[model samples]
Target: MTDKMLKFVKIGQQTPPKRDVGDRKDDFNEIYDDFIKQKAEEQSSRCSQCGVPFCQVHCPLSNNIPDWLKLTAEGRLKEAYELSQSTNNMPEVCGRICPQDRLCEGNCVIEQSGHGTVTIGSMEKYITDNAWEKGWVKPIEVKFEKDQSVGVIGAGPAGLAAAEQLRKNGYKITVYDRYDRAGGLLIYGIPNFKLEKYVVERRTKLLKDGGIEFVHNFEVGKDATLDQLRKKT
Candidate 1:
């Protein structure tokens, strides 16, 4: 009956076990280990469940932070992931790259009151990654059938997100990218220290599996002018 959130006082703060500086420096792999289930639960329980929830307020995507933290603490991972995905187009990616020290965790009420901020980003990542590993993650459902098709001009995060959303709503989506591969900026701009190329590749594969079309090495200006594509599509 006492199962609830706000256990920070009893639990203390913990980050994932980081690899040694020397070892991490020499490798391109992710430096922080994934939080084990017990550690993830403990960290999630540290949320103060603030009514105002500045953590959620500060998050650009306005994720329901307290809600998912409570779910994770209650060992309800599926619910946590669902709530997280409701607001974020890419929860796991944001969990890995978002500067939490300057955003959500920085605004946590308990952190202002002296306790270390709850490991919100790590907990978010854990919820989603565990969801995937457990087979809870599945292809997004088609909401409805639409005749009109949508053409997205890029394969970066924003364009990919738009394409996925359109496809989910039953619109045929075609993504055109100048690069030979999908994930324009995620592959070219971000280094492996922060994000791995395979993560982006897996997401692109998911989109392909869901009936979204991607045209790589196709240039809008060089290959076909805007007027040409508009006339074609």
Candidate 2:
């Protein structure tokens, strides 16, 4: 199995199949189809297992790409998802929007050798999407709840990521967003085709279910001043 796994020198690279441009432009749905079990394995098998992964070095968050790819190739998807999520606050979001042609996949060692780059972004999306479908994506599990609470002013990526990290550390988190939904740009700015609304909703729901409070349609200055919140907290 190990012998077969390191064959990027021989095998060609392949990415996920994308929707037709004309068809995809009509609506805000995912442009690419989800990787099938077999397809994901096949694609993962193209990894060169390089000694120094240029992909990891080039990644914004320096994710453990080769390890997670190996896990995915071996059909250990849940573990792969966890590994993928460790560094990335939003693997699914990054997978959807990240320009692979410019980042990790583009700098892949195998790609330099003309075998083409591993489809890192697509595989990431596959892992997270599979995790969600299988109910493997769970909320932050706090070890001990803290008495003190935090107020996150925005529901953007930074705020959400902060809230998740703090919640995991047992801090009571309260996210206040002006919109009705929790995700800031994720809910309104990004089109549905690239990232479906339900996917974002699922993560938000997990945070809510995990006891992180969300106050929607609440602006800091409009609903309550900074002074008022400071006193309340």
Best by TM-score: 1
Clashes of 1: 0
TM-score of each: 0.95, 0.93
Show where candidate 2 strays beyond 4 Å.
Answer: none
- lDDT score of residue 139 within candidate 1: 69
Error of 1 at 126 (Å): 0.9
Candidate 2: deviation at residue 7, Å?
A: 2.4
Note each model's CA RMSD in angstroms. 1.4, 1.6
Across residues 123-174, which tens digit of lDDT does each residue of candidate 1 receive? Answer: 8878888887897767666767688889899999999999988898899889
How many clashes (backbone N, Cα, C below 3 Å) per candidate? 0, 2
Q: Compose the digit string of candidate 2's lDDT tens values, residues 9-119.
A: 666677778899999988878888889988898888888787898899998889999989999889899999999999987898888888888999989888887778888
